[model samples]
Target: MKQGFVKVAAATPDIRVADVWHNCEEIRKLLSEAEKEGAKVIVFPELCLTGYTCQDLFTQDILLKEARRALERIAQQTKNSGSLVFVGMPLAVDGELYNVAAALNDGRILGFTTKTFLTNYGEFYEMRQFRQGPEKARVISYEGQEIWFGPQLLYQAEEMNELIVSAEICEDVWSPVPPSIQAAREGAVILVNCSASDETVGKDSYRQELIKGQSARLMAGYVYANAGDGESTTDLVFGGHNIIAENGTILKEARRFTNEMIISEIDISRMLGERRKNTTFQTAKERNLPRISFTVNLEETRLTRRFGANPFVPQNMEERAKRCEEILMIQAMGLKKRLLHTNSKTAVVGISGGLDSTLALLVTAKAFDMAGKKRKDIIAVTMPCFGTTDRTYHNACLMSEKLGATLREVPIADAVRTHFRDIGHDEDVHDVTYENAQARERTQVLMDIANQEMGMVIGTGDMSELALGWATYNGDHMSMYGVNASVPKTLVIHLVKYYADTCEDAELRAVLLDVLDTPVSPELLPPKDGEIAQKTEDLVGPYELHDFYLYYVLRFGFEPGKIYRLAKIAFEEQYDDETILKWLRTFYRRFFTQQFKRSCLPDGPKIGTVALSPRGDWRMPSDACAAVWMKDLENLTFNKTGGYSL
Candidate 1:
């Protein structure tokens, strides 16, 4: 598998009970279908060679003989398929019957992984006909060929070292210590379960959750294939419920009562990166598990997995609203603790009627409420300079009055001009110095007012600005406490809207709604015809794209090429390839060059997994080079017609 992505499938073939030849034919057909779809690893239901419903007939010599022949035929059929297949059957080893999942590839039986935990309770009587497999692996003669037979067989791909696979039967996973646990600790990235779980009322949900939880716990990909229709429904009905999951998220799930094959590409590199980050996931001290290697042609897998355009914000409205509420409470609580510890009597917030400032003011009010302080003691200041717009100024004053916070207006145009004259800079030259001077003057006003009022100046810059180093150093960047430090720009809009929708005061809600509708800008440059002239997105690209790049880069540590591929898929409908690549390059350059600002960031709470807290989740050196990452992007060629090639 190339790029550590291998397409895998979980197939539930329809088969008759005790009909070995028919079951083999169905398995071969499904296997061929999966092969055509470019699946490198395929798994089938347990005991499919002879259906799990074959209760007493399992002891018959004719059925066992036919099953052996069927296994050979399946193995022969996979000679040119180039897919590693796992099928189930009852095998006789050393005069004892064992329910086993046989691993076949390239006309050979690579290994046989037997069921470690037999299901003897409830409707299952597997212990009655089969013995539990041995804990240690051993070579056994099967049909004149020596095959590794045990419960701890690992199927590793020679092409990609991270594409290590392991198998376990149905009941084994249900047990407390699943064989997959050891397999994962021993370096298995993908775990396949050959399950024959019969259908019952409400059992499917539990089964699905169990598979998801196991994948999450082991930090590996899981493929589950269950038996389906065509089995003799003498006492129970098996509904083919196939599922493919990676690291707790289910990529594909087949509907019940319909024999379906579910296919999805597993991201082995992501799982390995997660493992590398998690300190608790320790590797086994004794690496004694038998490793069975298989060869497959390496190629980039066609991704069918869905990557959400907005990773920080949830897609579902209900879930998004819930998340927004929880995040607000978390931000408020963090600020509340800081205020209580500092014993401050007031909290000062610079209100610009912009998204970040609006959110900061709301959080400050919430913190005051949580700390049992008066809202009047919360100072809301609006600093108007040359770039101040009438609409934003009006909204700022109205919102402060409606929230019952003491509002103050500080016009800094005169102070900035005096400073400009002292520095011998032209007053008409609107450049970086002109913009940063206004920002620093506003910060000075806020800080001095906080000191005069016995309060703390709450920072308004969000995580997105911090990532791109968009905030002026020691200007809007410096504050006593940053409430929205970990929040991205994409999520800030949603959080403010959530509050507006839930607030009881109609006037306050109206102002918040207006603020959400206003364009994102820093208002550093002079206005054009009294309208805002400096748009942040127009210069730094869309925050949505930058946030997407930030998430993949920081959360998973994915390479630039891989992140670009995922971005193209996620934003295909909204942005062209050239636009995405352009912004992506900008994001990388800014993120690398701006680390010095983040190196000495103020204290803030981490709201999500992707945070830039220097002392916390991210600890990158300020002087790290971006040449290697930039070179990767430069190698990609993009055409004018929204197409790209690497």
Candidate 2:
């Protein structure tokens, strides 16, 4: 597998009722196709060895025996193919027939996972011919081969240690408690389901939701292979809705009614890390019936799934709008609670014509409105320093008036010059002090106004600034409440665009679109031809890359090398290899060093999986060293020959 990715497939092969030999040929063809696509693990639909719709024909002795022989032949055919494969059929154990997903690896039956729940409702009549399988496992001799079989089996990969595969049947997943849930809890990073769900109206949507929700609930990779076309249409039709999902998101899905294979490369390490962090998942594993044994040497598989450049924002417009609205509500509700509890009469925010400040101001307006207070009670302060441009100053004033908030401008050029003189800082040489002075002055003005007006100084810094520790300590970092504290810099742009899209007033929308277009800057240096002179990305690297690193690091707990690998794929069109590497190095250094800033972070609401709130999402010690993480990242640059394959 490439890095920790294990390419897996959920396939539905053409089948004929009660024709085990013909079915085996179809299985071989599909399996070979999956192996060619670098799928390390492959799954066929339930009763694929003999079509699920075989019905009473399932009682035929010759058909059952041929199904067993077909299983053996398929295992032998895939011995050299290197992938671990799952095929469903009937297995007789202790003189009782049980529906089973037979696990095969290297020409042998590694084990068999029996269906935990049998459906007798509506269309299923498996109970008439097959007994419900054992919940616990035991070695059983079948056709002179002893194999472990049960619902508790866990297929561990020796080659890819992080990769684990486990299986359950169709009805098992529909139960209140699915066996895959416990299987996932038991360290199986991927849960495969061999299903024979018949087609019905709106069934695909429900199936899609089930697969996605199961992945989310288990926090693991899920591959669902349902019965396909060509199954005996005696009373039901199965439109193969094969799916592959990771962590609740569908990565790939095959169109129903077509004989298709769904393939996806899942990050086993990420799923493993997620399971590690969730105490409940680990605890569930401990108490659930002991895990049964099935081991496979994971064949080396290449990744085919493409990661997104912007992980924070959705690509779909309708979904993006919904997400934007949800995020805005989260920010507003968080501020509203703080305001209500503190009994603050007003909220004071510095309006900078910049995106971060604009979003914070927008959220503040909503919070006040929800609290049944007048928008005028919001003290919107504009503090211009030495480098302030007329454009931003006027825009800030205009925004305050249009939003119906109290507009107050406090220019701090002379006061900051006096402070610089006191501190022996050269006014001509504008450096850290020069930049931080403006931010602190702006914060100071808002704080004093908030105090005087009996209001809260709502923080304007978003999650991105907090992640890279770009904001000055005790400057923009301190506030009564942070509205956009959990929002990433990448998402901030989309939120502005979302507001622009929804604005009723063309003039206000025009201003918002311009604000969205504006390069993120503090406007703390003299304007160059009436434009921003101090762009943030030029100094600290792109927030896109930093936010990418932060999400994988904090949310998935991915190693530096893994994050670097995925980033290259996500931003291949935008950033060259060396440029991405350089920025990745910078991200690791800043993120680890900035733990001190995050360790004492002010109160904020966590809107996403990635958050740096000291007391909540993040609890790392400020003094923790970055040496190990840096060294790993540096190693990637040295061995830069990887990812040469297009």
The numbered model that scores best in TM-score is: 1
**lDDT tens digits, residue span 1-646, model 2:** 6557878899999998888999999999999898888787899999999989887777788888999989999989777666889999988777788899998887778888999899898987888989998868877887787778889588776555666788999989899999887777667788999999999999999999999999988888899999989898878989999999998999999999998998888877777777778876663526444343334445455556888888888989899999999998888889989999998988999888999999988888888888788999998888887667777777788777877899887888888888898899998887888888877877888888888888889988988888778888888888888888889999989888888788787777877877887788888788888778889999889889988888888888888777887888899889877777788788877877887877777788889888888788888877778899888766763445644221
TM-score of each: 0.99, 0.95
Candidate 2 Cα lDDT to native: 0.84
Clashes of each: 0, 1
lDDT of 1 by residue, 403-493 (tens): 8899999999999999999999898999999999999999999999999998899999999999999999999999999999999999999
Lowest lDDT 10-mer window, candidate 2? 637-646
Worst lDDT 10-window in candidate 1 = 637-646
